[model samples]
Target: MANTAFMKPRAVSDALSAIVGKGPMPRTQVTKKLWDYIKKNKMQNPKNKRNIIPDEKLAKVLGSKKEISMFEMTKKVSNHLS
Candidate 1:
């Protein structure tokens, strides 16, 4: 079986906690919550589905980047976890 290390819960940073709530949560749940927030806020770029236009809350987590690719989004989010 594949290792489950990546599934272990980790502390969410303040910036991310603002969006996903404060807690130690698994990476999958974090990603799911992020996507849910994105969809709820209609932050996805219409022209490019893979790109995300972060809203004010996400901006803080993204270090104020106006937009980022989905892949890059994951990388940035990883920094917020311990």
Candidate 2:
């Protein structure tokens, strides 16, 4: 059975919304949209694909760090979801 928790819609912060779009959206959808933006912009680090090079809009969502891992991205993104 699918985990309903991940499918429940949640409020998204302004910063996150810039990357994932304005939402009351599910975490699954948020992740999907986020990945779509990332790939579209080619944000992944060349030598280290696990690292995401957050752009200006993404920087607001993930902070102004130089880079962050996919795992860290997930963790930080959750903070923007309520």
Candidate 3:
């Protein structure tokens, strides 16, 4: 089997509520779901491809930042995980 250590899954319970709905999901899944939310909502900042605009719910998780870059996004979002 593929080594799962480097690819730990995110628990849905950990991320669902903060991410979209509810979770007990893996990190990869959470990231996927997050991207899904982003894409579905057109959250990517058009002017700057690396930046993202958080919606109301996302803003809460993002600490009220109107915009964030892809790099900063992960750091900001980690706060909502626990």
TM-score of every candidate relative to the true structure: 0.93, 0.95, 0.75
TM-score winner, 1 or 2: 2
Per-residue alpha-carbon lDDT of model 2 for 39-72, expressed as tens digits?
A: 9999999999999999899989888757999999
- Model 1 TM-score, 2 decimals: 0.93
* Winner by TM-score: 2
Candidate achieving higher TM-score, 2 or 3: 2
> Which runs in model 2 stand beyond 4 Å of their true positions?
none
Q: Provide the overall lDDT of each model, using Cα atoms, as 2-decimal numbers.
A: 0.92, 0.94, 0.70
TM-score of 3: 0.75
Candidates sorted by lDDT, best first: 2, 1, 3
lDDT comparing candidate 3 with the true structure: 0.70
Q: What lDDT score is found at residue 31 in candidate 2?
A: 97
Flag clash pairs in model 1: none
Clash pairs for candidate 2: none
lDDT of candidate 1 at residue 40, scale 0 to 100: 92
For model 3, residues 26-80, the per-residue Cα lDDT tens digits are 5666677789989988999888878899888787777775788888888776665
